[model samples]
Target chain A: MTRLTRHDARRILDGRDRSGRLGALLDAAAASARPAELGGEDDVLTAFRAAPRHAVRPSRRFLARFVVVKAVIAVALLGGVALAASSSLTPGGEGSPGQPVAEGGRADPAPNTPTEPVETPTAPTPSPSDTSIKPFKGEDGEDPPEPGRPSGKRLKQLCRLFLDDPRGARAEKDYPGLEERAGSLERVRRFCERLLGEGGDDGDGKGEDPQDTNPSPKPSASHEDTSGPGGPHNGPQGHKGLSARSDGTYVG
Target chain B: MRPPPPETDTELSACVDAARSGDEDAFRALFRAVQPRLLRYLRVLVGADAEDVASETWLQIARDLRGFKGDFDGFRGWAATIGRHRALDHVRHQRRRPAAPVPDEDLTDLEAPSDTAAMAVDALSTDAALTLIASLPQDQAEAVLLRVVMGLDARSAGKVLGKRPGAVRTAAHRGLRRLAARLGPDADARPTDPMIPAGALTPRDAT
Candidate 1:
């Protein structure tokens, strides 16, 4: 069967659905359904107040939760910002500080004091000082020769170059073309051997040379490993300051 | 099927919005506007225990109003749905009980039958009308109450009744017809032209 319309129901409720006798019946039916004030408005108010807070609306508890969420997001954002800033400030941390020193064994070296004068390469017969070994095989503006294990001959050349031209060692960090094997055990051994004068070269006026010329108190701060006079002396302090600055910036 | 309630007053809508946000004063206004009819609807459906069902219904309404997603008419329909559920629960609870409701407790609030004849307005007694409505099947009685008393449209009433709009409409028509029949031929003043056609009022005829 087709249904009664809501309009019809409203008509019945309002006593307007039917007219004449039917209207009277609708009116009579609706009148009996009139809301007898169950109680006063105060009762309703009391009931409304009595309802649990969560049921009522978004209460203060929700506001408190939202505040907590906002606080967490803010702290996370600040942390991200701090990390970004500190990373930019200190590019090299502990991981990269010991980077330039390629070979671990060559960390200790004799002081950078050239026995031979650089101006005169024309030593008679070059018998006393061996000029046969050249540490830097490459000429100016050319790539150096390929590096290999330092032999006795290669160490003599490395020690001679480390003292006379320490820039060559510094340049290896910037351009590791061929002098990549610049620091090796054999090279370190040869350097020490040269300090002791393995041959009779110490007898030919080498006795006047200062025997103990190691630069810094720390063995790690090798004179040949540093570029300038200040490079060896202030290198450790500079490294410490960088690390401390990164820490302070990270926490701040 | 149900056209929305015609109470589109800006102030009442604003009050509903405020009530949804847990504004006590706005809810108070809302309660005042809809309570009377809601109570009456409950009365028709649950008889003497209507007030108790109504309180339960209000508790649910207050709890769920925050999530309610409609204007004033939607609010009314929503409330009627809750009230219907409460009434059913009360009915179910009553059915399980071995003892019938005590007559004294049932008759306590209303005036005694002797006094009602003298004091009842328009000589149309609530007790008499409720008795007539209660005689109809549960679906028909609730349909009539929700549609007529609560001012819910067919669709909304159907939603509350858990019936299709067509079904709710049919129930209401049958209910009114049954009431007219019980009241007798004399009650139907217009006999020749029936308000509800024999087949029932379809959506087409409702227009």
Candidate 2:
């Protein structure tokens, strides 16, 4: 038997083989049509009918836009949360400076009580102290001689002394200047009691100064007290008396 | 033959264009021309599952037709490519080699005529011829089937097999030589056998 050449094979594959046997073999292979070969034609046509004319693949632009939108929303949400957190934290820190002062007052009562009385005695004897206390007295005093508008400094001093030794300070000999400026011993005690109560309860003493003036409408009594203390005492006396009356009105 | 004369390239190109435009009859014509060839090619790769694989192949072809761009020859190559992919997928899924070629004993039962005159007159049965071709090594078997049985040129067959045209042609030549040797001396001796009419030996329409 002769060997099949590349030429012969090409011819046979091209269906030009006249050499008979291999051509017949290829013919038979091609001719053999099983029913199953075309059986699914209907199914294929059905699939074709259901297919979209131009199926949509997710384009690059659409995907990029979607990602950008998501990123924007995420950044906006984070920024809003950060802004809210900073705004909330700032006021909370600034608004409560009073807490630390109140805590300090409670924590060092021993030192504050002793220092306050000594400071008060030294303060009233000095002319320099009187000049310094005058501006504060003027700013705080609304009535000329009413006891409702005392300077904060003087009221706090009297409160400390009265609270320390109310009976001792009430005696005319021990603090003659203080008793005279306060109008009477009983009034000094009452004024000191109100100052301590309001200061302790309010915790923020700096914030309570304006509020203390609302109740000091007893100018007639303060005028009488100022006239009795005489000229040298009038300025300081009027200042202290007005403050005491103011504190009284506030307490009342 | 169930299919009419093998469609000329222009006819197939027209059918593809019509099918893309939703012409049902044109799509049916395209299926008729391509399915049998796809089935026979797949059979060499996937055995009994060729039918299922071919069905999958056709479904893909139908759906993706709108995106296709080529002449009829290109369409054939495209369909064959889809079939080859689906066949390999089936083989991997099943985790087995192409079902062993019809056993030697089964081939013996077909009693393929040894005489060139008898072969020319009666022809080997389609199943028997395919079994004989399948007996060749896989590369040669696929080369012969794609080139001869599927009516693809060497370049198109090479595209389907992922080989160069030269390699596919060589494989096909070797396969035919082997098939000739198997058919024995008489079949090989008569290169110009007078008994076989030229018309009778022309490539049969697959569909």
lDDT of 2 by residue, A41-160 (tens): 887788777664523212322443454455445445444544654667654344433233333433234323333332221112213222111111111112113233434665666556
| lDDT (tens digit, per residue) of candidate 1 on B1-207 | 121223444566677778766688888777766775677677655556667667666664664455444556656766775565455445433433425552324533532233343335532334444444544566677677676666667766765554576988888888877765554454334643223323322222121
In model 2, what is the error at residue B74, expressed in angstroms? 0.7
For the candidates in turn, chain A alone yields TM-scores of: 0.22, 0.21
Give the Cα lDDT of each candidate. Answer: 0.46, 0.53
- Across A1-252, the per-residue lDDT of candidate 1 in tens digits comes to 223455655576544555644455444444422334434456556655654453322343344345545544544544444465456655433343323232222321111112112211111121212221111111011212344445455444554443333324312222222123333211232243354377433322222322212323333222221211222223343323322322221111
How well docked is model 1, in DockQ terms? 0.05
The regions of model 1 sitting more than 4 angstroms off are A1-16, A32-35, A52-56, A59-252, B1-11, B20-25, B62-69, B104-108, B111-119, B186-207
| Each prediction's TM-score versus the true structure | 0.48, 0.48
Residue pairs with clashing backbones, model 1: A4-B169, A4-B170, A11-A17, A21-B189
Evaluate candidate 2 and give its CAPRI docking class based on DockQ. incorrect
Error of 2 at A234 (Å): 99
